[model samples]
Target: MDSAVITDTKTSMKAIFSDFKQLTKVGLSLSVVFSSVAGYLLAIDVINYFTLFLLALGGFFMVGASNAFNQIIEKDTDAIMKRTQNRPLPTSRMSVKIALTIAILFTVSGIAILYSINPKTALFGAISIFLYTSVYTPLKSVTPLAVFVGAIPGAIPFMLGWVAATNQFGIEAGFLFMIQFFWQFPHFWAIGWLQYEEYKKAGFNMLPMNTKDKGAVKQIIFYTVIMILVSIVPVLKLSGAFYIHPITAIIVALLGIYMLYFGVKLHRSEENKDARKLMLSSILYITLVPIIYVVDKFLH
Candidate 1:
């Protein structure tokens, strides 16, 4: 084969891989998989590597499917938004039919993989995809409550692990769900506030007030308080099998307070930089809280 042809092939392959990465929102999806595995680790006492692998793989594909569907649904709007304009679908690097096929394949494979663990896991997997694609995607254009609706699916990955482990959706699982559910509001609102200009070019209204103003900041603070309160609930041992150590809860509380401090800064200054700080803090808080829970359980 000609060297020129060989180089072209390699470049094409790299382009294809990069496009798929963007289409799947690989970095974001991996964090979601982490959330699921963290829940699985929290729920299971003994290590089951096979089940763990399946949970992580299924969770990734589930998130991948949702992202693909989201891009496909909002290709036009996403194209208009600076944050999403370069995505494969919006950039026309990949055709809609191809993206849809990938989404369908992911959905089917993800659910099947989860089903191997148990029926309930598969059910939750399907439900998350359906809610994300069917409901939340459409709601984004209509109302700010879309954020509230989207939170339902966003919250599930953590609790999905417990269901995967025990095949039961109990108070323990519900507790995990609530923590992530409230967390979503502030996390997403911060993003919305920061991207308010870009979002104005699109057709979405994720912010409660659709503006970076006092009302929006207040809503973010309210949800931040609720999220912090929920994070401390595991100390109550609301679930017989899933409580965190008191010390860990203390750590989690302090992390929440750290995040809220940024929220307060944003409230006081009403600065875009403050919103960015709050967003970073929220990410840090969510990432650490789960680790604290899983680590605290193992250490003590």
Candidate 2:
């Protein structure tokens, strides 16, 4: 092989890799997969490695497809936002044809993998993609309620794993869903707070009150309170299969308080720095709480 041919091949491979990463939003997809896996772990006494792999792969494909479609739909707005200007679609690093192809492939592949696990898991996975791309993506430019719409798909993952494991829906699954559902409010609101100006400039209605003021901060704090309360509810149930140990409850509550402290600071100070801190804490809170659930289960 000629040196120039080898160099060209390497460059083409790098571009392809970069496009795949950007299109899938790899880090975010992995985090979503982690939540699904955590839910699966919590719901099952024995681990099936093949089922676990299928869950992670199918979950990633579903999330990646949604992100791809979102990027394609919002390519125009994304091109305008500082945070998204350099993405594959915006920079012309990837053609719409290629992006669309990847999206369709992921969608099909994801559904098939999940269908192998259970029909319920596949149904919820399909619902997630539809709601995210068809409903949530377009709503971002039209209403602040887009966040609420987006949360529906967002909340599905944690409960999704439960359904995949047990192939049935119950209060335990609903509990997991509610926990993630409420958690998104504070998580995404902090993001809205941090990116208000950019999102506004891009014609995206992310903030609840459409302004970065007392209204938005108040709502953030309100949701944070609800989120914390929801996180502790498992402990209140004395007769459930999903109740966590009291010690784990204390740990989760402490994490919630850590997140809430930043929420309050963001409210009082009205500082972007605190909003950023709140965002980080929310990430930490979500990440740890699920692991704590699994650990508390084993130790119970």
Model 2 per-residue lDDT tens digits across residues 102-219: 9999999999999999999999999999999999999998999999999999999999999999998899899899889989988999999999889989988898968888789888
Report the number of backbone clashes for model 2: 0
TM-score against truth, every candidate: 0.98, 0.98
| Colliding residue pairs in candidate 2 | none
- lDDT measured at residue 226 in model 1 versus the true structure, 0 to 100: 92
Query: Which structure among the candidates has the greatest lDDT?
Result: 2
Residue 106 alpha-carbon offset, candidate 2, angstroms: 0.6
Which regions of candidate 1 fall more than 4 Å away from where they truly are?
none
lDDT, candidate 2, at 9: 99
For candidate 1, the 10 contiguous residues with the lowest summed lDDT are: 203-212
